[model samples]
Target: MIQKQLYFNNNMRQLIKSCKLGRDWKKNRNFHSYKAVQEDAKILVQPMHDSETRELSFKKNSNVLIQDGLLRFHSKDIKNNF
Candidate 1:
């Protein structure tokens, strides 16, 4: 087994690791001006879905839809609107 000494504690190391990854994470700010702003197109833009599965797709929450470069969805009060 290989043992390594970490400079930072577990939580500090995790925070720095997340910060390093965050540098590469970019948000699409020009979403409103997107040419094809359809749900299907939005889904295609992000390869976060499984190609084999025909599910509409979702993020952490089931009722939430992450599209148009934004997190959109109805609140519990307006959920019945759909």
Candidate 2:
């Protein structure tokens, strides 16, 4: 009876250790997955930010060009009149 009790205790300890190890492995796996998702999100957002900046830059350059053209045109008209 004591031998049987010792065997039961040993099995229970093994089971508890396995359970704890499984939980730790699962937690580590989940943490890596979360980090991968965060990296992917950053990669996805970076291109959108770059495109938005480029679009804004293009618009500003276009406005500057248009204003320059208008100024030149007015200046030519004034020189011709004088």
Candidate whose TM-score is highest: 1
Query: Would you give me the overall lDDT of model 2?
Result: 0.15
Candidates' RMSD to native: 14.9, 35.7
Please give each candidate's TM-score: 0.18, 0.11
Predicted candidate 2 versus true structure: per-residue lDDT over 6-62, tens digit per residue: 123222100110000111111223232211112111111111112221111111111
Best by lDDT: 1
- Model 2: residues >4 Å from true position, as ranges? 1-28, 34-44, 48-82
Candidate 1 residue runs with Cα over 4 Å from true position: 1-62, 77-82
Question: Candidate 2, clashing residue pairs?
Answer: none
Clashing pairs in 1: none
TM-score of 1: 0.18
Cα error, residue 6 of model 2, in Å, equals 59
State the lDDT of candidate 1 residue by residue for 1-82, as single tens digits.
1112123232110001101111212234443221222222222221222123121222222222243333332232111211
Count of clashing residue pairs in every prediction: 0, 0
